[model samples]
Target: MMVLLISTSIMFSCKEKANVLKESIEADIIIYGGTSAAISAAVEAKRSGKSVIVVSPDKHLGGLTSGGLGWTDTGDKSVIGGLAREFYHRVYKYYNTDEAWQWQPKEEYGNTGQGTPAMDGENRTMWIFEPHVAEKVFEDLVKEDSIRVDRDEWLDRENGVVLEGGNIKSFSTLSGKTYSGKIFLDATYEGDLMAAAGVSYHVGREGKDVYGEEWNGVQTGVLHHKHWFESDISPYVVPGDPSSGLLPRVSAENPGEKHSGDDKIQAYCFRMCMTDHEPNRVPFPKPDGYDPMQYELMARVFDTGRKDWFQKFDAIPNHKTDTNNHGPFSSDNIGMNYDYPEASYERRKEIIKEHEQYQKGLLWFVANDPRVPKDIQLKMQKWGLAKDEFTDNGNWPHQIYVREARRMVGEFVMTENELLKKRKTPNPIGLGSYTMDSHNVQRYIKPDGFVQNEGDIGVETNGPYTISYGSLVPKKNECKNLLVPVCVSSSHIAFGSIRMEPVFMILGQSAAAAAVLAINENTTVQNVDYNKLKEVLVAKGQIVE
Candidate 1:
């Protein structure tokens, strides 16, 4: 009897192990990202009666939206619709509650906003918010929708996507977990999934003639924003000694010809969330390898009597500010992130850490260093990182804003023509109205022997223009079951406008709806009927044209 009992127990244990092996996860749609787009896509899929999962490399959701970028980059509020606008309305609803205001009184935080009213009482939309509030909103969306999110599931880019006859059967992550789906959406900023799937994409600025775009290439001559140095700053380590070599952050290479194309990408910076409220502030700590001489150029710029030091301290709520890069030498670690687009996971982590150290050191220098102007240093001392935010990541934002990355060269390549409304957009999925904005791509030596920042262009679109549905999908031959919304097919200049968080949610919802439509019809994503898709999108309140 004892022998039989032991044998039966062993048998049960083996069966349990087998059951665990058999319990692999599967979904109708698999969204690979944790950006705002990923959440929208998952919610839309659930609403359409399809099971979806969000497998992301990031631990947090909502990307930059929940990161430090609380001040919205919205161009036209009317163009935002569907799940995108719904999100803002939810933000409005959250703030409406008495408990939502923690650090400040609701009445005190009056009706100040950007171009439009931030606290819109009529339409019920709130554009600007705190970072933690945005994150909570995203978390509420996932919980309310009952969406499954697998965080920190890094995609095995080398050999993970198992494609069967141009269709992704499944993809594995570095964690040895595999997710299977009928339809897939690559909602990542870097377009990692699309790149891994062998989809065609462009990394840097395309030549002007490639897409017949005026702002597509090396824009050395154009100076749109006040980001460039107003007066020429010497690039030498010693004031005028070229033999002393270039100073830190100043590249010695020649900036390419004006309007010529190159592989350089725009500068990226952390949109810092700082507060003067001492109770909720963490003083900036000196980072390892702190070098005060690195910012010599900025010190010189300040010495030139430019007192607009606090120009871009865009305010949010609760005495906090969305501090962005402003002036010639500010928060933007320019020309240091060239390898981030195609970098490996480990390499990318290193880059992110490097940025974090640089920014932290900069803040420390501005507040405490004797080299900084006395007036500016005194003012900066009052501001520090919000202690209530990003508790898991040391009060710093988890995600850096990847302004531009690998853009899928899908069926329709959105250029300035489409943005400027020179050509009609076909099968409209969403609308984008933000200016064709691009930050300085490279800070290099000019021909006249002075340091200058290049590739900052800002040209307003004629009006709200439709984003093509074709831009979301890979070429019909490349992959039929995949949709890329965040990294949609667009030129470098065009993406600067479409890369907004709200626009991403709009396209993400559209992509999810299309995926469901394709699944229902037993057809490929490319073969889904546009008329049928439009009907569903309109019903869902998408701004489809």
Candidate 2:
């Protein structure tokens, strides 16, 4: 490996002349994300005797795992194997020490998970944890494995990647640093590298006819979750007055027909880390653009005798809760993130800021607004941002949950048919058992002139299902050296199941194993020997059923 340094002069906003230094590093494998999957891939690559580097736009690792989704969306514990399970095992080890449980006693903390033990004694795994603890565990892995991670290095999506003969030769970041590798893994939620490399991908939901699947497209009538407005709440500012204009956040467009295709995606929100503990709680600050009228619909919903604002206040360790979007109008700023999938970096930052402002304002409204029910207001006031977590970023999560993004159209596509056990999957690399869950894509006026949210679907998989290896690699003609674990080749509905954090780590390990094999055999990633790859993965304790 060699590092080449290049120097250039650039002018900044202040018109100040500064020297821009660029470094080009060569490695056997290049992982272009700081997600949990990216860490796992780097660990696997190092174990296979390959030099690897993690070029991440994020300062922190573990994506949502280290972010605030600490509730753990994993379905079956048995399916989580290899490095993914090892990660949980590390969490268990962390908690075994007295220092890990700072807010509560270890014995007093009750064990609770998704129908599983929060602290699994038999398997030596811990499922539920705080956000900082998860980040620490991931950081420990990087340290122990000596994995090099370059933080806050954004990929130049428009003109960064260089492809030669259907393979990526090298890719440069906005920092002007270039990375050349024999194989690359796009483990990011946004699939920035894959998109910049000219790989085919899909952003929106496909019609049922295209995939021959029931849950692929716009779902108008299905009410899987309690996220929709229960009562016939008016969409207008004045009740039943169309000329009064639509209420804030409610879409003016008509919700399309059921099962029809549309270029819409599920809403995104920050899985807020909140605590009610007296010493650790930081009171919600009223955002800059806090608008009381924005939550007028929620206030009306409360008038209809509903007080379930704390329904999804899922508990984590140390009195912290991974508070999520709940009810008709809650943390989810619906329909505001449709342009985020393919938007520019600058535009994406604006969207993120808008989401943060909307969610923060919602919390502040619930805590202080007189329009809210007195009981709800008092309860919300008790909880605040955790003081011990995210200290660098105003006690809020640093990453926003990009629930779904650009999914690569690779050699194989995982669909609901495979998830529902109607069709057999091939070349099993990992197992995904989470429910096929997708949040509402749009909130629009119903034919009855009432506001309603659409596209929320939650259907449980029959059991743990195998994820194919082909889902990770692009088509042979498209890109030979790249593998995508986070944005795998799958239909929108099927991706809901595969998008879980543990499954992403599993696929990351599998992708790394395949890349190592391809590098050893001097073949394309598509041409890697599956039998040998499966053998190596299983030997490493991966669940490759």
Candidate 3:
């Protein structure tokens, strides 16, 4: 009888352990992402007297900001406020100290930025910085707030999100860890959580008629930036021989009609942080699949006597650069990454690996290939990957420049009309003043049979324009307790302006504030009082105007 009782007690204890393991992690707010917006949202939520947890796929905290996009894209600096501005102030404080400038003197690194001073002493903000500095800042922000973050946790897109009466009850990661929250924030660049939650979203470019705006769809002729080929370059492998087939990286498909939409997204590339400081530089490693023929198109571009190869090696601090895609055949891996937005995690990893290989091979080809111009080759050989950046990722940027991705079709769709000041934005939550920029989408054979790049649009906005609060929340019927800050509800052209990192941080804080207000009032995110939200935002140092 005693032996039978011991067996029963052991069975009950095992059952209790299983039940405890199955219990979900509960919080007042849950944020999914590790971007700048995610960190800002988590911090703001914690400050609002709510328990918040950040489930991050990335091991590192800040997305592109710390991942080598050190050169901040600030259109109008005064419009930036709240925690976003505070972040820059923190950067300023770090740079103000003598120890911050290790490799270069403070006086040597001039205050040159995008039409403004990089380090604004009057405003106490530093726009340009190094990768490690930005990461430290983000880490400190969350650490000070005591917010919980679970790193390297990927969302199970297939069956992760659980909805009960149009509200997200909980979501599970691939590791079988579930989190239940009163409100959720999808701060990812790809909008994985939003899409998994059955929220409405558009993947690629939309027709001009869909948004009633120019520069929305397939722009075959409208090349704004210097990314297009200047001189005529043949797409054929054997120069002008059509039967020789097309060279690599050149698409053969029809680039669609102008102003008409098809499923195509802008190119993606790694914003490499390179340095000429020999002691702190690691020579660019040749990728495993080093194919010189892959960059034959670039060789042709260099053959055209184009010497502006170093135009976009923008300097940040300590002799390091936020090297971006510059010329026609530079870093932007055109005609790729179309299906990356909605692809599965495994497929996305493959895509990211391909991008990394392509970029690394491009660097090798430019530096070592005999086909490249001697001047450009010699200059490229001088620069190498910064040894201090992305230590775990082989000195490469941890985050890829996912310029555009799945955009949610939510309560209000901001179009170029709003950015151009033709239509006024209502219920302003933040401000964006950057140009409506889109990178080259396709590199295809023109109708005349010459190689030309398409879908690079760069239309300037009408100064600082207000971003609507409705853009962050989904429609009333789709989901009730979710807000998206990174992939907000905006048309392609409008999102081009709103997708800036600082603006993302601004929207993140606003979204968290709205989430807290909704939780307190026992209401949906769509039902949050705009007046109360705006008041709270203003009180918290957010520039609503």
Candidate 4:
């Protein structure tokens, strides 16, 4: 009987170790994001000497950081510090070796590098590379640390269980894998985990009235650029035939009258990676269900003798280009993404496929159509998809350019005052320097019977501005273990600047520091001492300024 009792005790002890109690596998911190911020946060959490786990919905990490926005949008490189600086330094390293410039001449590679400071030698940053290269860097982070990583483990927002009495007990994923951590970080771009935990969040553009933001919500009359000049332009489909109605994609409405805003997110598109070198290029394949009629408006713009249409795809290094929507009726599919923020998973898939088709079709239209000027077509012909990138996803990019979406409405809502370089918050965790940029949200048919665009607001950030710490914290009543880095609490206009990848990493490092500090104090992430947080951030070489 004594021997039997001892055996039972041993069995229970083994089982307990196998299934580490909520506090065992729970780690000191848990981050829900697959974006750059998420990875940086995880890396920082480990470096800060805390066990961490990354539960990401995305199969591939680095969001847009590794997606396609390869040309970093670095305003003042001096302000970049911590993991943000390290990321660029890695990019510099990727390009320093002669093997990196396989397609172009060593000298023609322009050692000067993408209009930024030299990122050469061991302390370099290979800032420009294929999406796969960026993913490799993120992979290196996990390999470097014995940190736990669960990919495609989407937080079961509703009914996933975030036990909160201002502290998270455990949150379950769709896989039924429950993660219990002392401190949680919602580093996701969508803030899904935070929202599911009953945290307050905003969808679409807040009206100018709510935030008193000049660039918030609907701006029907503000025309930033003229890529589609219907003044002398013909229609995209067929010119001068109202009986044929408008193009398939062109909306025939007068957008909206509100000055502030409604719940409409900005237009989204894929960032195509193109190589000018033919050997490296995979010519734009004719997308299935391709239609030339949809691009009739584009052809009409070309007919008007527009030369600046090609300027949108800004040139980058190694014979590559960072494509951006330049003028009116550019690459962005305006007004069509109104339901995306609250869209169901399947519906979001449909939206992404539609965007892919639109982008692919646009490339085909430009590549094969006779309407495109010969010289311009020739220039475009030199470029094609990077064959090495997005290998499993049919040469199409896995991550869509979700420029802005589902910003959290948390303890501190960063408004235009913060973005326009006006007010400073005491709980600042990071700084954003990008402009308040939002692409055209809606397209409308004018009274003149021509299409007009609205909602493309671009107000540059005057200087570096602090991102509030409250932005990361969920309401004290909601789950308190979480720290939001990507979808931090902010007005739509303000999030644009804070949306940069470098800024995300900076925020990620700061967020991890805060999360670990919370675990040590056995308090909510909100109650972390700001002075200590700043000290750790600065000591870690993070430019909190």
Computed on alpha carbons, the lDDT of every model, listed in order, comes to 0.89, 0.92, 0.91, 0.76
Alpha-carbon lDDT of model 4:
0.76
Instruction: Give the Cα-based TM-score of candidate 4 against the true structure.
Output: 0.91
- The candidate that wins on lDDT is 2
Candidate 3 or 4, higher TM-score? 3
Most TM-score-accurate candidate: 2
Model 2 clash number: 0
Q: List the residue pairs that clash in candidate 1.
A: none
Better of 2 and 3 by lDDT: 2
Candidate 2 per-residue C-alpha lDDT over 162-242 given as tens digits, one digit per residue, 9 for 90 to 100: 999999999999988999999999999999999999889999899999779999798987898899988888989999999
lDDT per residue as tens, model 4, 121-150 = 444555555577688889988888766788
Q: Give a tens-digit lDDT track for model 3, residues 1-545.
A: 00101111122463464322343688899999999999999999998899999999999999999988988998999999999999999999999999998989999997788877899899999999999999999999988988889999999899989999999999999876788889999999999999999999987889999979988999988878899999999989899999999899999998888989888888999999999999899999999979998999899988889888899999999999999999899889997799999888888899999999999999999999998888889989999999888899899999999998999999998899988889889999989999999999999898889999998999989699999999999998999999999899998878888999999999999999999999999999999999999999999999988
Model 2, global lDDT: 0.92
Query: Candidate 2: where are CA atoms >4 Å away?
Result: 1-18
Model 1 Cα displacement at 343 (Å)? 0.8
- Greater lDDT among 1 and 4 belongs to 1
Q: In candidate 2, how many Å is residue 109 off?
A: 1.6
